[model samples]
Target: PLMYPCRFNLSTRSIHELAARKAIRSLEGHDLKDVSEYTDHNSEKYKKMVEWIARDLDVSTLRYQTADDMIKAIGRPKENLCLYCWTGECPKSARPKAAITIDIVEVKPDATRTKEIKVEL
Candidate 1:
């Protein structure tokens, strides 16, 4: 649903918009692919990409409320998502982290999904 360091600050709204745009663009054209991956861990090759993201995206408080809006905009196109990006102290970078957790309450096929989701670091 979101990349690593999923936290976002409301101050950087413009940057947040750009990041959402990029995520939407990447997620488009793929069917049945529900996972989002950062795929960049401070690699020499992705340095440019990271720089571009920092320049074009705003994620100061993404995890706050902007992330919810982004996910809402994206909708449920894929079943699961895997986000992988640089997870340390950077600016507006995507990283890999667990988005949601699910526990089986019953062995029924129609078992209910968790009403509240827990994110793990």
Candidate 2:
């Protein structure tokens, strides 16, 4: 079983999709579970993805976590932490700043037609 701290947030979902397509396909049809405590945990899209992937992987069971339960497990005040990953809401004090951008390019394709990733800084 594997546990995901934040399941429903946009960034989390993007990472999961990337993993499903690239990372976890090698271990296909395996039983796995993702534990989360988001209030929107059971929302339609999130639950559907869970069920679909579980079936694709043949997972035996699926479960989720409640916000209170997660808070208790973390043993910290919500204000002291960045809950953006879980709630998709940035703290009031957080401000946006310029970020470095990088680009990825594939070169020298091989047997599987996959090639080395060239990152442009």
- Per-residue alpha-carbon lDDT of candidate 2 for residues 23-81, written as tens digits (9 for 90 to 100): 23334444244423212555664555456556766877655554456556655555544
Model 2: residue 107 alpha-carbon error in angstroms: 35
What's the TM-score of every candidate structure?
A: 0.23, 0.41
The alpha-carbon deviation from the true structure for residue 82 of candidate 1, after best TM-score superposition, in angstroms, is 7.7
Tens digits of per-residue lDDT for model 1, 1-121: 1233224331223323444335434444332232223333334423333444555556332222233343354453223321221222322122346455422111124652322234453
Q: Which stretches of candidate 1 lie over 4 Å from their true place?
A: 1-38, 57-115, 118-121
TM-score of 2: 0.41
Please estimate how well model 1 matches the true structure, expressed as its whole-model Cα lDDT. Answer: 0.33
Tell me model 2's lDDT, rounded to 2 decimals.
Answer: 0.40
Model 1 residue 85 lDDT score: 19
Number of the top lDDT candidate: 2
